[model samples]
Target: MGEILLPLLILCPLAASMIVSVSAGRMGACAIGTVACTGVGISAVISIILSITLLSGPPAGVLQVTLWPWMHIAGFSADIAFMLDRVSMVMILVVTIVGLLIHVYAAGYMRDDPGIARFFGCMTLFVAAMLVLVLASDLLCLFIGWEGVGLCSYLLIGFWYNDPANTAAARKAFYMTRMGDVALLCGLLLLATATGSLRIGAVLAAVTNGQLAPSGVNLAALFILVGALAKSAQIPFQTWLPDAMAGPTPTSALIHAATMVTAGIYLIARLHDLFAMATPIMALTAILGTLTLLMGACTALVQSDLKRILAWSTISQLGYMFLALGCGVWQAALFHLMTHAFFKALLFLTAGAVIMRTGHEQDIFRLGGLRHAMPGLSAAFAVGASALAGLPLVTAGFYSKEMILSGVWHVHFGLTREWTLSGHPLWGIALLGAFLTALYIFRCVFIVFCGKKQGTSATGRTSRLMSIPLGCLCFLSLCGGVIEMPDTLPPLHLFSTLLDPKTPLSHADEPIWLVLAGALAPLAGLGVAWVLWGRATPVMHEIPGQAAIIRLARTGWGMDALYDRVFVQPFRLLTWLTHHDVLAHAITATGRLTQAVSGRIFQARTGFLDILSIWGSRGTGWMAYLLGQLDNGRVRWYAAWIAGGLCAGLAMAVLS
Candidate 1:
């Protein structure tokens, strides 16, 4: 039953995608959307049933099914297998349920577009790939889905390929993520070589039992970490994400906000045991995550475009998840990942509605006093913003964020007691990021929805299809974190215990002040936002002659410009220098010389064939004579000659 169901879960959406692709020009938008949604809806139902069965069966319950052998070469093997444990259950639910909602919303969001069929086709295919990524039991098999999402992302991000900027954004995303993919492939090879298998269980067991050298473990972990960083858009690789807003809003919601960007977190958490043994890499992860969190928050604070703000916010939120993983509180990271998906998806979808109705106006400063005109949308946006800001006690973001903060505060990593890395500084930075998160997101909310009407006026009302998903996500954004609470709240470790029964997450002995600090950071940020932009006369437009620091923050601290000068300029220079094909010319010269030499040689070879034939006949006669010497009358010599002839014949047959 599990085997049949597991394959069905992937095949449903995959088959739908194929159908849509093959019948694209012949199908109407409604038919396309219905087919896409129905496929995901069925997968969602299967995921729920699987989740219920896993939870009800046992603490260590897992449903694994191998449909067939994926590959077998020499000493290497992999299987087309699926595994549904607690971690995957959470991921599948997020991928399918959130993915379905986005599809439903996209139906209305893209209703009038001519390429609606293509959009649905890529969207459905993306969901199927994500499902494969989360469910695979073998690392090699997981990579198939890993690359699958990347390809789908490229296609969807460049869906409107007529626009040069859109295609450029797509290419940029592809190239940058490919860098990390290369590193990830190297890491997987290292693990496979050491463990002699790519199965997740075997890899983890080998690492835990000291089958790999210390250096090997660290290098593998480090390589995988680099891949995750690029995928998740951590610092130094984050420029592509903001530009990714060139895609459609639902694309942003599905790929950037909910699923694809979180692939790194999932990969790391899935191999937590391997990471645990590499403490230095763990520290590096935590440090890099902290820097990205702070940088993304600061960059988001000054963005005027609506989607770019959310893009940076997604980067920042993922940093929090990475920080938790680094601190060894993976459950906290996964919890935040779930909640972030809900609110972030809600925000993107709601923003899409606002953009569509307001004549596609994306500049927040140019739009104002929208709450009175679109009360429901304004309300939904507020819910998403509050959850993103972690407004205490009421929002899902607060609980998950609090879990991360608590986990960071108590974490200690080092080679020795005196040289240990403490989490106190990281906790402080995260809190600061929290305040900035509230300030930036609420700043957008206030400037867009709180004051007098200004630039672009509302044009159309949001359709029921888009509104329904908004309402569902709004509810989820506020209530999804109840399954995990802090020490100060009613004790509930449902999320932690469900993920791992042996060591359920707890912050029981921590002081009460930590929770209070986490709760206050966002509240204070909200108060500050109200003072700045939430007034009757809101600060809606960009100020003239902005300070240098303000300009820097707005430009993502000039990281793109720096990268261009440091990397892009040098490469372009090299390309230009080689544009005339000097090496190719040199090779061409050599080829011409060879051609001339061969021409002369051919002219002199008129009788060479006959001479070569005579030499070959003589050589053959000599070899036959030597073989004839083995025909001595002794039975032993004859038997040996026969066996040699048979072995030579068998070798030729096999080779042929």
Candidate 2:
């Protein structure tokens, strides 16, 4: 039963998609949508049970169910197999539950679209792909799932294919991710070549046992990091994520915010042991994460579109998770990933509801005072905002974010002697990033939900199904921490027994003052936001340099413009030169040369009959004339004429 269950989890959604596609018009689309979502929900529940049973029982604590031998070589083999363990359990739970909520939300959200059946089918396929990705026992299987999710994202993002911007955004997302996928493939190749296995467990064992060369391991880790960075939309590769908001809001909720984007973090956590071997690469991860964290927060502050703001925030939050992993806190990163899924999805869905009610207007500047008109939406969004802002005891964001910060501090202070490298001072940078995170988060909250209504009121009311998920997510945002937080403070430790079965809690001692400072940074940012934008007569107008600072923060610190000048423009120029100067010149030159040769050959052919007639008159005509003379019975005279004609013809030709 267990062996069959794993395969069932993946196949159910795929089968549902096929059924929906075949019966699109005949069957009621809504009914098909419902059945597909329900199947996914059932699969998700089964995965949870399986994960729990495995986590509770064994030392290896993994269920490996192989369906077939996918590929094999001299020393490498990959199978269509499912692996159930603690990490996969976390991913499967998040993917299914949140995915189900989004599916339900989409039922209403996308009801009016003519392609509802197609949308639902794609969504089901997406869920199945993500499930396969999270549960795959080997790298090859994971890559298949990885590319599958990428394909689904492209489809859903361009669901409204008529919209040029939507299509463009979809292409950008796909191509940019493909860039990362290339790197990931290279990484897989290197891993297989070095360790002679694609199986996750075997690869990890080899890495841990020092069987693989250090250089090969480092390169493989870095190549994998490149893929993770691009897929997750970290620094330099992050531009596509903002444009991806052109997709349907539910897609933004499920793929951009909740599920798909988190795959990068999941990859890092899943391969923590291998990554741990490369200290320099891990340091680079921390640096990149910090840069992206700050970059995202700055960009979010200035975004007028509600979804764009959330998109940037998603990027920022993902940065924090990466930071956690980079700092050697895999568990903490996963914890944050879980919490983020709940809150971010809630925020995006609530934002969707608001947008739908307002006739698709998304500008935060035009929106205000929704607390009175849509109390449920306002409340739900507020809960999500609180969680995002890391407000005290308000939501899961605080606990999860706190865990990540603690991990950063531990890394900064060289607390983990086992993993310490260059001893870079990241505590201050991480602290500043946290501060910016709170400021922008609360800034969005205050502008969109707390202020006076700046624009027209919402025309339609939010549906009950829409509000139900929001309510559940709101409640979870507030209390989800209780299930995830540590038992004590200062030296906070996780209480997730499922995560650490043997220890259940790993405590590290740190300075009390450092811990207090770390805890207070988010609070300080919240205060700053309140003073700057919370009040009627805000500090933005009062302070001398405040306006400029706000403007800079809003403009994403001019990073976009910098990127345009440095990377985008250069690439564009190279493309132009290659196309116009090199390829076009070669093609045009070839055409012109061919035309010139043809013109000369055609001119030479023009007098061909004249030349042929001249030659015939000189030789054959003279001979015929002399023969006619001979036949006339003047034989001696004809012979004399023939010789005279021949001599005359030869003399004439020589003179000419």
What TM-score would candidate 2 get against the native?
Answer: 0.85
What lDDT, from 0 to 1, does candidate 1 have? 0.93
Clashing residue pairs in candidate 2 are none
Q: Candidate 1 on 1-656: residue-level lDDT in tens?
A: 67788889999999999999999899988999999999999999999988988888989989999989988887678998899999999999999999999999998888889999899989999999999999999999999999999999999989999999999999989989999999999999999888888999999999999999989999999999999999999977998899999989999999999999999999999999999999999999999999999999988888889999999999999999999999999999999999999999999999999999998999998899999889999999999999999999899999999999999999999855669989999999999999999999999998999866887899778899999999999999999989998877888999999999989999889788899999999999998888888888655445333699888888888988998898889988889769978788889999999999999899779669878999999999999998788665799878887999999999999999
* After superposition, candidate 2 runs with Cα above 4 Å error: 412-424, 486-496, 503-505, 541-656
Clashes (candidate 1): 0
lDDT of 2 by residue, 84-155 (tens): 887888888888888888888888788778888888888899999999999999999999999999999999
CA-lDDT, candidates in order: 0.93, 0.82
**How many residue-pair clashes does candidate 2 contain?**
0
- RMSD from true fold, candidate 2: 8.2
Quick one: best TM-score, which candidate?
1
